[model samples]
Target: MSQKIGILTSGGDSPGLNAAIRGVGKSARGAYGMEVIGFRDGFRGLVEDRTVTLGGGALSGILTLGGTILGTSRDKPHKMPVGGEVRDMTDAIVETYRRHQLDALVCLGGGGTQKNALQLHQKGLRVLTLPKTIDNDVAMTDTTFGFDTALGIATDAIDRLHSTAHSHHRIIVVEVMGHRAGWLTLGAGIAGGADVILIPEIPYSVQTVADAIQERVRSGKPFSIVAVAEGAVTRDEHTAMAAALQRRETASSKEERKKAKAWIQRLEEESTDHTLRLAHQLESLTDLEARVTILGHLQRGGTPSAADRLLSTRLGTACADLIEQGVGGVMVAARGEGVEAVPLEEVAGQKKLVPADHPWIDSARRVGTSFGD
Candidate 1:
């Protein structure tokens, strides 16, 4: 008998997930003649044994769909809400896997999904993952599937914001989505020709941003568009964050480490409306009217771009091929024009941050864009 394959999506929903699912399911069922089982709501569904058999009909015409067909959730295997309390359901998940006779489990998601898939891989089950995040911060891949669509949405928002900024002669601070990495903000900022761009990768100063706007005003440009990543922080805040992380990473005692970890989580939770605060600060410093427009979920809701569709299809088909061979513990990573199966160990729990000297940053600098550094 042919092997039975399982698939699930985890973490935040992204554009092109359906396309990836279709790519994998169609190939697995049609070409390789495998029985495809789709677990719903991520790891939670696996623990609860909720699934749908994905035949060719179920996978058809979903290439342009926006979300996963099997559905998705943020539940982790080790700590998901079971009844009223959190519980470790890894053994339950393994039981489900064994009961279903799955030859391999395919996971589609971002960085966190990769980590969770790694946990499953360690449990001695065959596992494969696909990179799927708008942040494009999954380590080892050229770019994740949803990033192109999100980037285009953010760029279009910035393009639209330019007209209002020009009309009001105001400093319009347009915040883009990116929790830790600034790929979305930086890309849209450059593409939209913003006067100033602030990203989380580089620490920035509000005063520097204000001074740049003032310079633009003196040079006959009355309006300024400041593109900021949601997670971008002031230089001083970045300094404190670095110190806290160092403490957490180098604590001499378990109690000290726990305290530092708590502090770090607190710092992250307090970052709400950071863009609004920056806008007000710039208004005071530059003596200009300032407005804030946060592009929140607008970035995450959209039709997948042509590039994203192509990438998802490519990675998805590659996943099916690997599953046919019973390969496991690897993420199907996009490398140049082709795909490569990277070991999950190299991808799990790792972040692909923008380097200081990345070409994108250099180009932005050479074109006279201010990073507010």
Candidate 2:
């Protein structure tokens, strides 16, 4: 009997997910003569036995596709629902592996997917992981597949913002996606020629940001561009600002609590708020017209770039190789030119944040980009 391999895409969907799936399916079936089956909607499909045979026209022309054909979900196997009640589906997942007689399983997703894969492995399933996130926050991997595409999208948005900021002579803040890491914002900011870039790794003061804009204005450049990440926080001076909001939340009445929660949610999601709040503070302090433009969801939707397609293909192929080598509970990661399989334990819960002295960051600094510190 031919070896059977099950594959699934999980967590937030990205552009290169289909490419990775196609790579694994085509290589495993054509090269190794193995049977490839795709699990629909992540681990939920596996638990529910929702699978489809993958071969022939099913995997054709998917290298440049934007999302996974297998679908994806954020649901965890441990918390999967059974009938009408939530139940631990780990044993069910293992049972499905036995029912299908799968020799190995390929999981393609970001950090959260890797964590769940690790847990499944502990339950005795042979598994290999392919890193897939726009954030590129997964450790061990040099760069995840979808990051390049997201960077391109964010860069284009920033480039377009330049004309609007210049035309109106106002400060334009373009927010991009990056929770803890600044890879997307940093790369896009540099490519887009942002005057100031803010990231979670480096905290910034509102006054310093306002001063940077003022300095640009003083130099006859009346307009400025600020690129900020979603999770970017203000410097220590704004510690009291967040504290004041928290205090209001605590003291608010029941109806006021709902409003406070909504405001907090907006602050959490809005990269513009980070800059707008700073801009408003700057206006009060220096009187400048500051505006914010949020490039929400625009960064997440698009065709995968050539770089991302190639990277996803490489990672997918590496994952198949690892499984063939009987390597289980490992995430295939890109080091430099070569790919390495790192233990999932080392990758889960740990994030790869931007180092202060990274070469790219140094280059950004050399190019006169302020980090708003």
Candidate 3:
């Protein structure tokens, strides 16, 4: 009897998901002669016993597809929304797993998905994960699939915006998504040649950003482009946010925790409109017309780039190889030139953050980019 495996995509969808799926399905069926089935809408489908068989025809021609054919959702097994109320549906999922008799379950997602996969592993189910976030913030991996495609999209947007900024002599502030991490914004900013680059890793000052733009103006350049991460914060806001998070971590009572949560929520709400606020501040300080552009989901849509497709296929096939070797409870991490089966415990609940002294940061600084620090 050939080994049978199940696959699902969880959390946010990305450009290379389908390629990754195709890689796993094709390799499992051809190289290892293993049977494969996909769960729809992530863990929710497992709970509901929704599935699709991944035969040869099902895996064909998905190498350049953008999203997952199996679909995805943000639902967690332990606290999933069933009917109307939230319920622990882990038992239902385990029952379905037993019914299918899967030798291993492959999950493709980002940081949250890693944590959720770890939970399933603790329940005594064989689980493996593949990192697939545009943010590229999954811990223990050199780079995640979907990031290269999104980086190209973001860089192109910034490149196009430069024309209007230069023509109108305007300060253009472009926001890129990365949640709490700065990899996306930092890489795009450097690649796009933005004058001011801001990310969550480096708390910035509005005054410093203004000064940088003003200095460019004094140097006979009246227009400047600013690349900012959506989670980028002013120095003052960062200080307050850090203090609130500390309070939440050390809270002794429910009421204290509640207060801390509210404080953090308020800060996040304020941060949501940070791009517009930044443009306004820059206009006031530099006396230049300012514009804002948010490359929101635009970065997440499109066929996978060549780099992304290659990485997805690499990780996905490595996942199949690990499962064939009876490996369980690990993520198929991309090392420098090869892959590694990193234990899920090391990856879950951890985020890969850019170091302040990283070579990328130094290179950006050398090219006259200001981080507004």
Candidate 4:
């Protein structure tokens, strides 16, 4: 009998999801002569046994589309809300998998999805994953598909903001999304030519940022632009987090560890309004009119860029090739101008954080970009 594969998108949606889906479905069906089906709305759909066949017509014309036709959700198979209560639904998902007799299952998503795929793999289901996130923080991969499109959108937004900042002679603080990683904010900050860029990798000082803006004002540049990552933290906050993490690591009892973990979580939750506070602080310190703009979810929408489409298609087809070769429990990672199958163990629960001494940071510094360090 011919092989059959299942596909699903999990977590937050990004721009190049459809391209990846088409690349996998078309290549699997047309090139490998295999049957392909997609689970709707991610793991919830799989638990409910909801599906859609990816035949000729369904796969056509989606290569340049923005989102997934199969839809997506952030539901986890092991901990899903069913019957008004959060319950373990892994067994139900496993039953659905067996009912469909899938030879392999492909999951397209970001960090959380990778970890979730690992759980399914441990359940003895043949599982593979693809990197898909605007954050670009997936480990063991050169880059994720949704990142390029998001970077373009963020850069364009910053470019447009420059005109208004210059006209009004004011400070504009722009927030970009990258949960606990600085790749997206750093890339867009440099590409957009922002005067000061702050990322989570480097804890920023408010006084340092104010000094940078004042220096620009002294140089006759009356307006300034600040690009900050959503996860970026003040130096004091970073220090406090480090201490809390240390406490968690050193805690002897489970109760103590749990308490430390909750403290860390609360600290992170409180930092959600950091960007707005940053604007107010800057205005007070620098005596300049400051404005804040939060690019929330705006970066996730829109069509995939040419580079993203190419990357998505490349990874998708490569996933088909691996499925044909009987590979499982791996992620189709993008290497330099090629693709590689990385073990799921190496990808799950890990993040590809931007290094302080990365070449991009050096280049940006050389071009007079201040990181507010």
Q: Return the TM-score for candidate 1, rounded to 2 decimals.
A: 0.98
In order, candidate lDDTs are 0.92, 0.85, 0.94, 0.95
Q: Tens-digit lDDT track for model 1 on 199-275?
A: 99999988999999999999999999999998899988898889999999999999999999998988887777788
Candidate 2 Cα errors over 4 Å, as ranges:
81-86, 237-276
Give each model a TM-score: 0.98, 0.89, 0.99, 0.98
Q: List the residue pairs that clash in candidate 1.
A: none
Off by over 4 Å in 1: none
Model 4 lDDT, residue 65, Cα: 84
lDDT score for residue 196 of model 2: 93
Clash counts for the predictions, in order? 0, 0, 0, 0
For residue 37, what is the lDDT in candidate 1? 84
Score residue 107 of candidate 3 by CA lDDT. Answer: 97
User: In the order shown, what is each candidate's alpha-carbon RMSD?
Assistant: 1.1, 4.7, 0.8, 0.9
Q: Once all C-alphas are superposed, what RMSD does model 4 give against the true structure? A: 0.9
**Ten contiguous residues with the weakest lDDT in model 1:** 265-274
lDDT of 2 by residue, 149-244 (tens): 999999988988899989988888777887768989999999999999989888888778878888988999989898988778886634644764
Over 1-373, each residue of candidate 3 has an lDDT whose tens digit, in order, gives: 7899999999999999999999899888999999999999999999999999999888999898898899999999999988899999988888999999999999999999999999889999999999999999999999999999999999999999999999999999999999989999999999999999999999999999999999998999999999999989999999999999999999999999999999999989988899999999889999999999999999998899999999999999999999899999999999987999999999999999889999999999999999998
Q: Which 10 successive residues of model 2 have the least lDDT summed?
A: 235-244
Q: Which candidate is the best by lDDT?
A: 4
